[model samples]
Target: MRFRMILLIGTSLMLASFTMPGPTTSPTLDRDLEPVVVAGQQMPSFAGVPLDQLFVYAYSGGTWHQIPWQFDEVQDSTIVSSEDGLLDADDQLVFMVADTGDQASQEAWIADENSRQYPRYEVVVTDPLDPSKRGWVYVYHSATLASSVTQDYVNFDEVQALVTSDRYLLGLMTDHPSMDRLELNGSGVDILDRTKIRAEIQFLGTYTEEDLEASRPAATRDGRVRVVIGSGDLIAYRSMFQNILWIDLTSVPMRVLWGRFSTDLSPTASGSYYYDANTSSGVVVDGVSDSVATSPASDWAQVSGTTGTMVRVVDSTEAGGTPSTYYKDDGAVDPTDTGDQRSYGDAGVRLDDPNRQFTFRTWTYVLPPDQPNVGATYRSYARNPLQAQTNEQYHPDFATAPPTATSTPTETPTAPPSMTPTVTPSATPSATPTPTSAPTDTPTLTATPTHTPTATTTHTPTPTATPTTTASMTPTSTPTDTPTPTVRWRVYLPMLRARGSARNAQNGLVLSACLVLGSTPPRIVAEVGA
Candidate 1:
């Protein structure tokens, strides 16, 4: 999958605009004019008061700190001079509009009031011409000013635009005081080091007096993965928080090898003769040979040499082709078995056939766990038994050939022939077995037999074995079970799941932010201006 890069440009715009009845007047300043009007009406309770009767305060470090201010007597507006550098970049200036006529009212507001009998307004300042420049001011009634006053310092629209433009975003929202230390300790930043994948990082819902709110309709609302972090143990306050990490894997093309098998004989019949048939009339025909060897010559000699002067013969009358049968000693069968025949059955047949062929096949599929909407492909291969003996490698070619046979023989050899042919029969001229048309290799990517997703912690999932195998070549009378090859790739994606607790929430926030931002303890100090 691919993504388009987002570019952002900053522009300057009008600041705050609120209306209230006041005498129009303009203020005189000592410096060059780049005046930013901070005009707003005072709370109705203090409406009739003169501009000199009201004082403005800035909230910083959890306390309302006072700063020098001047009122615009002409425009009838409040003005804060930026020439003295009182407002720095990225400053969450919480200014309170105080109607303090004396020191008593100021002290009461400083002590932190329980009720909101005072009026206050919050504003976030960012230079439109330089969106990165952060500076802001707020206003509240002197009587209503409290330590616990809700702080609305972050602008949701601005943050969403900034992060989405970069394509990938990761953020943390927590009220934990230990967050700064955790960043330094590498609790979160270390995870990012494990991979080279890059993403944009932003701090959200931090330093605001309000508990983190759930803004579900924001840019991060769709296709977002959330992880809750915290200690499971019970604590006084469950500081639960959320960490969101969004990645676009469409650009990351994952090539997965789905399935593979070598061409070879079936597991039970490999390295052994396919047929052990005898003529209707028992006859030991010497020097009979098959066009092809069923078992190796060494295997046939093992039985013939043991039995005195046993002969090999071929029957050309068979429909497909002449198959080799062997003649052997009568003692090949157990003496207690009364049904056994010494002349015509197992004991006197050819051991190997050269004209026979075998086919082997295996199947597999590839899937993306997180992106289910995206489709995946299936891979498979096939080969004949003889080809499998030499080259065990599987290819994508959809040849109709059988899977390669196992290198190591797994089946036991059948018991040696028990009975000898009673009559010596003449050998008929042998005919070669006609070759059958090869099966067409049809490799299909269809998802037959749905697969289950495997869980893994690593970025790449490990391949596992599947139980499906298809082998063709074994005789119908004597069925053989072939073990299917087990070679398939499985993908496991990373995920975090946790219950919402206050402690966990704080941990989640710090951890999530650190993960996205790639900031260390020292860097975090600069990030939050600590």
Candidate 2:
């Protein structure tokens, strides 16, 4: 899920509307947790479907059950529901894979709305990367049962630019490429050391350096966080600085200091541990002390601290593969000042090949630490995402409809032709579900005015590694959760033996009652003819 890296300036003004960017889209988030998003343009067949008559349904347990869905209409940059009730290029369709799968009941050949459960959710890992996995959902245009109710898993606070997911809370920073706050949802453990989580850049032409700040919130959509910023703060002090833009080998959530997962705040309840793509076993990073410049490059990472919770997020770039875990060199800093951190573990990359512009995509997730599956196959799958084959076919209900399953997605997406600055950052309220259940946030798109409009750039120092610290990967164990599998069913008919051995319609589902005689036994039955 590669998306353009953008930044935005935040203001106290709450957005009047929400979710939509200029003509562009962005920021592939929660590959493991976010819902599946399908834009109107991607599915041409949707053009003729009336907005009010549309519905979303996930295939599971052999039948077609109606699921909840929302139609977010777009007017340039902001989201408006049912405004025009049209499925246009500016609009999108989103739904959770949680309620879909290749699983089907033995009688799937005949299951229908009358036999399926309504408002039930299913949890299945349908990542197309797993070659053997079969996963898909359906979008239907119905005249009779278009859902009248839908649920929201993610929420964004337009003014705070804070994204509250099911598992954690993220507050995007406007002053730099870092966060103002990042906390585990229920534990109240703030993962980031808020005082300073910033990105400093180094340009080669003038050999000058400057700190970049967000320009505005660009795109606004659930499961997508986007902001618009330049190589340097384009509106502040360093206005006359060099035009040279250096694509440092890395650029991601360059978090800061002690209060984070480092030595000062390591989780003690169940010991501390971390996981990375570089190794099969979990590394221990129980924050007993500080370390710097850990494994330089790893595609994915997970951590847990005092709350006994495990959280993970990945950072990658088109310019330099996956971003590395590196740090900036700050020669002068207090060893005791937790707020003024100089060297910290950065998920962002430091590009060896500099470029003026490249696609940078990343997102963090707070996985529930309630699972007993640390050794499960999914962890291994995360380290190496394999490719696979898919065959999507609708339930018997839509027997005439074409199969909607798609092929495996490419690791990196080709940016849309119109690079109209993808939307801005995401946000949320403090309350939400765990990361495993999925969460998201979308702000009021770029159509909303920004708080700050300066054009001068800000100063940021060059990034360098601290030679003395230990590897950032530590050895320890963290907690996790395994979601429950949901199976759907309507009626269970017992196999009635007849005539000393033969069975009558082993799968009995009589369409109507046919008994005519009222015997002395005077027995009666229900409508299902059970």
Top lDDT model = 2
lDDT of 2: 0.32
In candidate 1, what are the lDDT values of residues 1-530, reduced to their tens digit?
Answer: 12222221111111111111122212121111011223221122233443333445444434455443433221101111222222221111112111111111111233334223333332222222333433323333343333332332112232322111111122222221111111111122211101011111122111111111211122211111111121100000001111111111111122111111101111111122212222212222122222323332111111111111111111112112222323232323344222221212122222122112211111111111111111111110100000000011111121333222221111111001110000100111111111111112212111122111111000000012211222322110111111111111111111212211111221121111111122232111101110
Shift of residue 450 alpha carbon in model 1, Å: 53
Give candidate 2 regions above 4 Å deviation: 1-34, 39-43, 59-64, 71-84, 88-91, 101-129, 174-177, 194-210, 215-219, 222-271, 278-296, 306-317, 320-324, 327-348, 370-530
TM-score (all chains, Cα) for each model: 0.15, 0.48
The regions of model 1 sitting more than 4 angstroms off are: 1-35, 41-53, 75-115, 143-530
lDDT of 1: 0.19
**lDDT at 396, model 2:** 29
Clashes of each: 63, 59
